[model samples]
Every structure is written in structure tokens, then in C-alpha cells.
Target: MTASPPAHDPEPPARRRGRPPRTESAGTRDRILAAAREEFSARGYEKTSVRGIAKAAGVDSALVHHYFGTKEQVFEAAIEVAFAPALNAPEAVAEGSPDAVGERLTRFVLGIWENPTTRTPLLAIVRSAVNNDTAAAVFRRLVAAQLLRRIAAQLELPDAELRAELAAAQLVGCAMLRYVIKVEPLASADLEQIIARVAPVVQGHLTAP
Candidate 1:
């Protein structure tokens, strides 16, 4: 029978070896994000390049550009992924009664930092921002614009923006101390107890007369 058609046409003539067909991988975007996080965390935004991220992710630099237009965009994506839980501050505050807003807000903020998955990337971002002006600017723009400003707008009180900032300061400072710096007592303190102490401060800032 013609040697069985030469076993499937000699394997299709060994397939021409030019460029491999580009088939999208399900995890490509996520892989890029993960690599971006690691790069930004290690080198800060200014030092982390698209090529660096692509190399880290084992893809071409073009792939990184394909997924994220610029280094700034990648940084923003990393921030969004890391702080997604805390981004719900508006909703957390909005869902609660005025008096309990602080508690809800505190719980929400701490809950994010308390989780191991979110905490690691966030710790890296904070550490990088502490010494990198570029990182700090990116952090400030994303947080102040998307989170603090929006939360402030929800308040009926005077100096709502200021209050929101103060509240953010309180939470951010606490997070820095507990999570980043790893200060004893505070770092290892009970989450509930910490919330009890911090919620009132946040509430005071949110509702000060």
C-alpha cells in the first residue's frame, strides 16, 4: 500500500522552520504582570526596563510591550494588582454607617496588609518607593487620585480632602510601621486590638468637627 503513504507524508516535510506560529498562552498576561512586579520591586520603576521584565519572564521585549505599553503602565498594573483589596476603601466606607466608617475602613486596610499574598508585593512597592522618587510619584498619583480623592469626595464635612489625606496617612503610617519596618509589638500585635486602636483615629480624621 505504498508503504502506508510513507507514514503521514514524512511528518509533513519536517515543517518549515521560520517563525513559530504565535499562539496566545492563557497565562501570558499574568506572567508578564508577575514579572513586572518582581522587576519593579527589585529595581524600582526607573531602573526596571521593558527588556529586563521580558527577560525575567522568558519572553521577547516585544511581548512585554505588547502586554504593557510603557514601564509606567506596567508599574500601574502592578500597583492595581497588589492593592486591589485596599482599592475598595470607598465601597467599604460607603457601606458602613457614618459612625462605623472608621472601623470598616481600618478593617479593610489591615485586612489587605495582613494577608500574605497581598502583603509581599505591597511591601516591595513601599520599599522601592521609599528611596525612589519615580516610584513615589507613581504611588502618589494612583493612590491620591483613585483612592484618597474619591473617598474624600464622599464626605460631607469641610476639608474633606484633608481629612481623607489624614486618614490615609494614619493607615499608611501604620502599615509602614507594622508591615514594612516590621516593628516589634506592632508588627506582631493582635489584628483586632490594632484595629480597635486605629479605627478611632481614622474615624476622628474622617469626622472631626
Candidate 2:
């Protein structure tokens, strides 16, 4: 049998050299986002460029575009990553009875802002948004698309869209004054106090007839 036709061993699978494949696009996206955040914080949105971000990320400028499209898209992506942990607020709020949703929402949002880790990146975004229309637009789109839309869908009130938008405006305004602008009493006020004071107002906007 021709020496039993020496057993043919299957070729060893190709070994992937270097780092293992990145399974999480979010991780790669987040690296680009962190670099963008630093760049925007340091250079301001107007001065920040894709090429700069690409250089910071150790990737080609084209790769940045491939991942995020335009600069506006990159800014939006950065905002999403920065605020992603909070994106579930609407669903969380909607889970409980309507009457208590606002309190839950308030607590959630305030907790995010009060946490030092989340707060730093958030503050950076807020500062950039205030100084640059591009950043502001990106912020607006993110809120409208992610937060407000989800809230509106869960709300059965008349003009739910308007209500969601109004609630977002109120919350964002409070954040601006308290965190970004650092207005005196609001800035120094304890988190519980702010949540207790603001939750009812937000609740009225969301659930009142």
C-alpha cells in the first residue's frame, strides 16, 4: 500500500502574529474617541483636525474616516462614547411607574455627572460644545437621536416629542449651570438636593397633561 501512504498531517493553521484580533469595535472606536476628546479639549473643536486625531491614535487619517466618516460624525461618536453609560436612562425611567420616572431619571443623570470618571470627559464635551457650534450640533444630535427619541417613544403623552425635547433642555440647562458654568449655589449644592428639587419639575414636563 506504498508504505500505507504516510499519514498526511493537516497543515498547521496560520498563526496570527502581533496582537490578537480586536473583537470590540467599540474599543477601537473608543481609542479614537479618547484621542479626539483630548484633542478637542486641548485645541478646541475648531482647531482639532482628523489628521491630528489619526496621528494621536497611530492610525492613518483615512482610517479615521473609514471608522467615523466626517469630522462631525467623529464628534458625534465621541459624544456617544462619553455619554453611553447614560443612554439607558430613558429605558430605566420607563421601567417604573410614570409618576416616579422623573426621580429615577434625575438620580441617574446626576449620578453620572457627580462621578469623577464620567464627569471629566463630560465636562470636556460641555466646554467644547459651549465654545464651538460644531460641537454643539453634535451634542444636540446625540441627545435628540439617542435620549429624546427613546424617551418620547416610551411616553404616551400628547406631543411626546415636544415633551421629551423640553425635558432634555431642562436637564441640559441644569447641567450647564451647575457643572459647566459652575454657577454658585447650584454648583456647590449637594447632589440629593438638586435631584429632589429638579425631579418634580422634570416630572411635570414629562407626565403632566
Candidate 3:
């Protein structure tokens, strides 16, 4: 009798359960940012938590911390993505006709608020900044350094840095009224009308003798 093939050893018992090693997936960072945007948008910055972001992202809380380090970092990342086109203002100012630079800058910056896609998160970030000193610092740094300073650097003027910041202040203030605060007449004002009124001020700041 062909002895039955030696019985295979019983399958090794399954390894006991334990936490799995953390793996950073390629899209994980992007996923986290998207989730963060939603959380901050829905709850505001102070109310948003890393655990909430992780829950929305379908990842462990530790994974969110691993990728972003802290909630403030996550907020900064979200704002950067939302403001990317505006943050690119330096290039627009750099390439445009000198006379039209202010108009182009005004349009580009306001156009972001005009677009619903970019506006919502911006509202969240601005609202958070208003309430939280830490958030305000992050917002101020990015706008000053990435957007304003770069424009200032390209100018041929005394105190170009201050000039650029003043122009930015006008645009940012307009955004606050027109978009965030939803001031009645300004909120409903015609885009061209608003642009017409604001661009001159910006031009003066940038090109005044």
C-alpha cells in the first residue's frame, strides 16, 4: 500500500494579532490634505482635529500625525494648496505688461475668490486666522513671503517691499468684505466694477513715482 503521502504538518497557527507596520502610500499626503480641507471647512481650524482628519481620510490617527506632524502644519498645507494660484502672483506680475500689471494682479487674486472651487477653503482659512493668532501668523507669512515679497522684489521702487504689501493689503481686504464677510453691496457688486475701482489703487501702490 503506497503509504499515504506523509501528512503535511498542520498549517502553522496564524500569527497573533498586533499592530501593523506603518506604510506611507504615495497618495497618502494628498488624501490627508483633502480630508483636512473638508474638516477645516466644516469645523473651522480650532475645531478641527488630527483624529477627525484621519477619520475622514480613512487612515489611522497616527498616520495623519506621521504625515503632517501637527494640526497647524496640516492647516498650512491646506491653505497652500487652496492659495496656490494666487501664490503664483509673482509670475503673473513678472510676465505681464508693466502698465497692466496691477489690473492683472487684481483680477487674478479676486478671480480666485470668484471661483467657488477656491473660495470655500479660503473662507475657512481666513475665518480661522481671524480667531487664532497662530493661524494668522501662518497665513501672514505665506502671503508676505510667497506672494507679496516676490512681487516686491520685481519692482523698481523705493521700499518695494512695503509697496507690494500695501497693494496686497488692499486686495486681501477686498476679499474679506466681498467673500468672507459677504458685505451686501460689495458682495453683489459687478466684477468689472470692483476691478475698476480697485486696480487703480493697486497700480498706484506698485507704480507711483
Q: Pick by lDDT: which candidate is best? A: 3
List model 1 lDDT by residue over 111-205, tens digit each: 98898877777876787677778778878887889898888988888999999999989999999999878899999999999999999999999
- The residue ranges of model 1 lying beyond 4 angstroms of the native Cα positions read 1-26
lDDT of 3: 0.81
Which residue pairs collide in model 2, if any?
none
The candidate with the higher lDDT, 1 or 3, is 3
55-100, model 2: which lDDT tens digit per residue? 7976556556756888878877777778887798887888978899
- Score residue 180 of candidate 1 by CA lDDT: 75
Model 2, position 100, has a per-residue lDDT of 92
Candidate number with the higher TM-score (1 or 2): 1
Best by TM-score: 3
The worst-scoring run of ten residues by lDDT in candidate 1 lies at 1-10
Against the true structure, candidate 1 has what lDDT?
A: 0.79
C-alpha TM-score for every candidate: 0.82, 0.77, 0.84
Q: Whole-model Cα lDDT per candidate?
A: 0.79, 0.75, 0.81
Candidate numbers, best TM-score first, in rank order: 3, 1, 2
Ten contiguous residues with the weakest lDDT in model 2: 1-10
> What stretches of model 2 exceed 4 Å from their correct place?
1-20, 23-29, 58-66, 131-133
